[model samples]
Target: MSVLFFDIGATLADVSVAADGSLTFHPRPRVVEVLDSFAQVRKGIISNPGPGATARENAAAALEAAFGGRFSDEALVHWGAKDRRGIFDGAVTSAGPGAGDCVFVGEDPDERVFAREAGMRTAAHPVFTLAAVEGRPVFWARIEAPDDRSPAELEAVAKLDEVVPVHVASDRLVLAMATARGVRAVEQSGFTADLRGQVGETSAFLVRDDRPVAVPVAFAQASAAFRATAEATMRAAAAFAFVSAELSGSRPPVSSLGPGPGGVYIAAAAGVPVEDVHIPGARPGHIERLLPDPALLSRPGQARAERFVTAFAPGAPSQETVDAVRAAVTPPALRAHVARISGAGPLVDGDPLTVRSRDASSADNERVVDALAGRLHELGLEVRRHEFTWRGHRLSNVEAELAAEASDAVVLVTAHLDSTGAEGEFFDSAGRSRPYDPAVDPAPGADDDGSGTAAVMATAECLSSMVASGRTPARSVRFVLFNAEEQGLVGSKAYARAAAAAGDAIAGVLQMDMIAGFQGGTRTMEIHAGSVVPGPVAGASDALADLVAQAGPAVAPDFTVQQLTGAADPAVGRSDHASFHERGWAAVAVSENFFDDTGPATGTRQYHRPGDTLLDRDHDTDYAASIARTVAVAALTLAGL
Candidate 1:
């Protein structure tokens, strides 16, 4: 069950005024309904600190009253600095119980940003804030309040066609207007009302075209007491919603939005003598600004072009190197070679490489393992084989080493040599396949880990050459071609177990699962730094990510570097790092950003299919090599070389 965390102030409750001009809490029922619908959901509040604990208590009380007991003392979170780390530390520690299955809600941009950083999805709310505008005070009076009206009401009264004019003094014309239209004004003041008098905001009102039909005023002496009462009464009448409906598309009309401290008036229409006509929902200064146009969806070709351009977007590996890498992976010769080797002859007739974990107990998987082992040896790494009896069948995990050393801290880089086969015979070479084939014998397994394996092999060659040139690695590096990784990180887990048992000081582990093949080289890498790693390990992970950005292809500035340091979740379990992390070690996966590309629903489909041949798409061997070099440098640095 997923847990949801909601912020109280702006999310659930709103501030309102009662009939007596007293402050009150108004809760949004729709929001509460959504919360009530979820059986697996929990709610909480996050608020900023107020004056002192007393202020906090009062705020909490208001929140609780609005939410009907959803909020508690523990649910209220406060931070001195309202920034990312501050927000995260406060929320995580207070609402720490549901970290793994939680999403946070808030209105502040900083709070939403912090929630995302803490590895939670965020929903932003539209909370109200204060806005200022310049305008004259417009008052309103209904015929219902007759004798009750005070002398201040007689001060600025105007009748239709009554020429009432006053000099603008101190930027404000204190005038009273009626709420109803066509009210007769018995002007007691000397100034007469002009029927042609303008009645819009300082700069927004269309007075020439939208002149008020009526405005009434009564003359009153300008005394200190009279001035105060008149000002207060006018302010009270200004509280109605008067927003420009045209400005607020699809929003409801208002008489006057609201008023705040400092003569901050909500937009409203001015009054003329006969009667006052107020346009609803017109906020002050709203007409001067125009809203941006709505966004349009991209055309099909445009989207493709965007993806293509972004893939090769300048930054990262040079175009020449990127092209070179592609040529190596899908070379015509290699394509022909794989076609001839598979015998289905040419992938057009063969199945896509199927990626899957060797279930060990599956008879067919063992045969495939033997064949894959032959292929590995043909490629030149010394293979280490282990076979176990499980359910009356043999399950094998093969490990091959390119370089070996003892007494040196081990840097293990590995990938599973498996595939998922799900495409059709269109991907099959010959008739040797299944319908909607999920797996086939000797699946090319190109991208699954095949690309990874080749990259590893290529990297191994680079390291081997460096070692042979009399440059012994300050730290021993072992590139293990792990079998059965596709089957739940079994091989990596087994390897991690052995390392732990042997008391091997593993400086760090970097796993590359799938790292090749996309149109136009749209390359993205997700740097995963484990949550449970010690300070040093996390620092190393972050440093390595920075190095990759600095040395590899043009990486996007917004490229993701996830620090899984707060809590463990599904993301951490989806790769080989789980095994190592389980044993209190530091491990992280560096792979293409698949999430942003394909929707999460369908995973990389070519995974275990026979069509997982190298010819499937352009491969970036240069990028692969750069990755090799980057990891090599990172390992060297991490191991103190």
Candidate 2:
């Protein structure tokens, strides 16, 4: 069992300050419902006290008023700052659960980082905390087919409420013989020999024009048996019809019935024409076997193992290099870069920088692209724009390559620089689909791609400085900012296709999307690699993932890296790296684990919303910088610097 720790402010209770300087504390919406939902789990609070004695007293008082009766005082840790891991350690000890089995839910990203460092899992919301405790996957899927039954028949099926006796018939002759003998003879017949005592009774033989059978057996058993005899021709001849019918107190069957023999059992049981069984989070397609599996390539040779050891052995990046990269990717520097690209700074007063829709004709979008290109030029690299047409829309991708002294292989680092608004309906916190006014609600996209863009810029600056100081790599490094990614990876797809057509010797591709927003849970970064990609490419992707995992501790030392292979969600292929995967290029996407909705790591709630701005409340530049550090080290390692 897991122990759950919650932060007070904005997490459990809402704090309000009136104009009159009075502070009011109230429970957050559905606080009681949320708490009641997790009644079985052990709970505690780990909140930092507000500044000063009076403020701390007020905070403690507020918590006491809200949750005093439910939680013990021993479970609350309201004194030290959250950044200190000791506070969480104490909470874990107080909760009497191992650090690995304890989870912390807090609104602040820094708090989450500290919690993770303390060996606890974190979540941004209480709902997500519940999901984490319950171990729910991020995505769900269902198979469905068109309903063609008459309204009357559908209504009659819907009115089913109780278990009804069913008669199984092998053929019309069997039915006729049973009908002639009446219900008594039918119950005594050997037809139900295997089903004796299992089924309550046999009351009637279903005719050709009768209501569908409602099996008296438990749904679990009936579903299992349906799958068992699905493909048996003899079993298929066993027709069933309801003998008794009621309208109330019937329980619906569980959703998943699992694959079995395949036939009419499900259709009869579900009270609908069987079309297809729905499987949540499952990819719909025919499974194709790949011979000489890609896993062979991931095996380490003696030489490769030695090389890995030498690369990360000790002080590989050196203290000076670490400081330089850290200084270059500072939050202040990244903030300035974000402001430059977004065009929303002190001068603009928070309006969106540009409407980067799919259309290439939008001058504002073009201007943002041009601004990024200009910044790349300032980094002492010659910028090139790859222009191509995708689905009738003209798109352009910006590239700036840092050539090596003697190698032709290229290491491509990419990030999309486009933003998406609420163009279509999106689900809200309550899982309700709602439409937003895009004109009034422009997607700031600061954390979505802006964080990635800024990280790339910061990386370019660091690499340029290193190159200027005579640290020339053996392999070329290509920095690319893709456009129209929000429009289904149009730009990157065209670029990858062009590269493949040109037969460029590319070593690997690292694509970044939504790196900044860290709404305090597990400080996890996910590396997404497509297993279905060509063998060499897939192997390279695995190698890169290993390198990244190693680089985190060596370079960033604070963030944890998680590798996800063949991620089930379709959205995994929604980014720019997918273009390279399609062309059989070695590529892996680096993103916050939160982007994967199938797990508790499902990232920031501010994604693609107007709230995805540079505000400290939502965005964490330090977290983004940590990711940049890891990427830089991984890139330099791949470049053989």
Candidate 3:
């Protein structure tokens, strides 16, 4: 008898787990129809449940509630991490002798690779189970009309069989994954842009698509094309997108996967412009994403301040005051802290680096937290660890709180500490990187977050010195380094959840992400103040952003801080600050220039990759200091220092 295994979460449904071990999952598009169609074939599960001892029970309860009597065999339902081949191997073994007779239907290509290794055929979407059973290779393709053609001409793409248009990039561009026959059909329609073979090579892409916009045709069209790709990727179909630095109107596109302010996010050739496939009128831009995040769909955009018709001037703090904050967070000090934590040197005494990936799965995660705690202890600060579980691993959100003489409100300076080298990246088998196995991948995320981590550390170090000198702020300040941030802000989310449960009054949060990357331009910095258009606490978020921008003139005179809020704030809910924002707490994200495409583009192409190490020249300590100082000054000012 033929048996089948299905992956849960994004593959089957969008999931939610209540505090009481109850699971609520909404089936994705055709999940029910597809599962019912395969009634003759025996179905089993190979899925990763939430952390804690009752995770399996929660998943089973949700499964049974959603599709009662569908998955009856308790023996076939295997719940475990699918990051490796062992789980698939066990599933195959349990299914009896003929492994080739079984098929696994899941979303992630990496998971598919493991199943393939277990001698089972794989399908990305449940809709493609027939193809998986029939042994047909499925391809994810981006089809777009020429710059000269209208987007409406490709409407028939939605009508095609075998080709699934997962994301509607634009009227002209559509991102879809299909079988060989579907690819042929799309090519016959006169729109042919085929990515490299298979999905496992690249996790996802940053697609940038807009109208057939005006010049600089060089970069605008590229950016537009990628925007569409980013949308497709946001829907979980990966395609090609360019890093911000490469699409500098003057420079050739450099292909490297990095999360954009928009968040599924993109990779390979150096200096080769991202393959811009179009049949008609093509506009140039870059494709960007965070892995198909529904939460980010309503998040704000990342345009420059100039995009808005109205504006507010920053608070005028004394230059001397700015200088005091700047003096506290120096380039050398920031670099030293970054070097210590980011695998350049030993993290404190006992922690040496074999690899520096703080991915939730890595044991090194705890060591990094302990190292940060050690530094805080040296400054005589109160350190605490809020431990949480994720993917069956124990992780902690490290914190160092400074008490106020008398105040009920608290200000938080935060950054995510976890890193990943494998997500949204591609390395040819012939090239150096031996297919990135998360179990052994190297994610020395020096810039992806080591920069932000260093900034947060420096902020604490400086503030601690001030407090030692008797300049205590009225409001308490908490310096937080979040763990497993790369795993969808797991630590921050937990913190937010607990704080909400306790009714903690958090005034505001200043989140600094990739501050060390300084490519060029007016040294412009972006203040992501969340969105104001329809958000509940837009007014509070706006004020918080203004505080950050006001710091630019005082501390970072050499750098220009373009404050963006309202509809266009790119980081909307993609960063850690979003956690607090969801709780109605005022918050903002500070980072390098990922917006302002017309200006000298700035930011790291090595985002989220193993290349985010201390050895890379992409990190600019001076720029990092400026950003750190900006955030530090704002936090201090808010705390009534």
Candidate 4:
């Protein structure tokens, strides 16, 4: 596989950036030598804003000076900073000769983590040369040692101005900087660019809060293009301050939390200085989430400053102040909070909708959910109504079907209504958060839960069809749509409780999440039947594995299963299946294994984020579909469908 490397800084330029903005430069000689060494390598340079040459107005002259005709202008790939962490995390995921064959190199530990998390070998730059001299004229320093460089670093240094990988981390800052430069950051949601921009040799000058620190206007205007880029960059920086301030979640009125003044008043009234409270990472628009209940402030006969005492830290309460405050402020009566968001009742409107990013909104999966619900409704099956809860939301749980033609055994199949990943809001269109919203940034979702939703819907649809065809099996089938799965297995827990409460005979639970990826055969599938349950359930798990080995090839026609043991623990219980096993329900989850199991090889990278879209370049939904088929086959066989 041909290795891939990336260039940081100017290539993915930071127009108006913070003082800590890191720049990764390549040693020209080492890069050229590596380029020559790999004769059959497919090489290309990916840049943003424009190539160094087009960054300024005197493009032709700058190109001649930098390349001497050795490189063509078309050699550069300009990818503006947008998302962070993934292929653009500056690590090589797929190699040139073939997929999963190459390596990635660059500087920056943050970038390295992003790449490593993406399942790529990463290297950091050990040395850098001074390309442009200014400020005391020639400032020289070697930050990291060359010989001690990591594999990714060496590879990245070798690809500088060559075939360096682009970044994968979110680029809110970089785009802010570009906007400061008067350059527009394209909001494609998730799509590849078709054209590139040109740039010329531009002198580097630092800008702090809109003011040029040391460079002279004479130097900036040495050329018209140079001046325009700088002017535009400065303007963008000024504009970005306002936009960033809005996003930083500072204080209210002007921010999300609450007005800055209101926060200060509340803190002061409590005798706690606003700074002492230390609400880290607060923005303006979301201050209400940080403050105490307003009812506490409106109590009758309470002195203005008396209410603050009760809000102090644990054990620091002043008895005199506390008693006086309690006397002054009467607490509200009869406010009850439930342990689980879901109640043992039917779903209600405005209970909050949960849909998986790739699954819930998927036209294919939506069809499946609808079809199955319709099928179940059509049959004379005695479906029960109950509430299924997860995260902080609730959903309707319906159960029906026979365990056996004459027996009372049961099988459970569940789909989550919540979506995963960063970019799922497009489905709501009415403007709801996908998995993570600006309300809750850093959404670790997408295929992780979204794909699972699809699998459950599909499986339910299949079973519903079978039932509608008058096929009465020996086992009872239960179809559940869970909520708040991303937070933990809360929904499943509620379901288990409800089942135990009603004394329902649940034989086993089969969970299918993120099934739209390859398992075995070429990549091979991994079965996770750890000792989450004991005795018959564990035995059933072993039997289920054998069944997959027997039936998967026929069902999927290719994939195979590699049963795994000894890795199940609290950490393993990331999905709803855990809740079932804990409740003594014979259950096992079938997934894409991700990096840890019999699942996708690249789960860590695109597992979430805007890049986790249907059109992600790396994810293969077709493979995912096949994997989903295997899961369905396994569930049907285990339930003796």
Candidate 2, run of 10 with poorest lDDT:
286-295
lDDT (10s digit) by residue, model 2, range 324-399: 6766778887887776655456312354444433123344555666666777887888677665432223345778
**Clash total of candidate 3:** 49
Every candidate's lDDT = 0.40, 0.54, 0.65, 0.36
The model with the greater TM-score, 1 or 2, is 2
- Residue 430 in candidate 2 has what lDDT? 100
Error of 4 at 254 (Å): 30
lDDT rank order: 3, 2, 1, 4
Give the range of the ten consecutive residues with the poorest summed lDDT in model 4. 332-341
Instruction: Please provide, for model 3 over 477-583, each residue's C-alpha lDDT reduced to its tens digit, 9 standing for 90 to 100.
Output: 99888876665566786666555534466777889888888766568788888542233456677877888887676778888777777645556555787666655
Estimate the overall C-alpha local distance difference test score of candidate 2: 0.54
Prediction 1 global C-alpha lDDT: 0.40
TM-score of each: 0.39, 0.49, 0.55, 0.39
Q: Runs in model 1 with CA error above 4 Å? A: 1-383, 388-393, 401-406, 422-442, 531-570, 596-605, 618-623, 636-641
TM-score of 3: 0.55
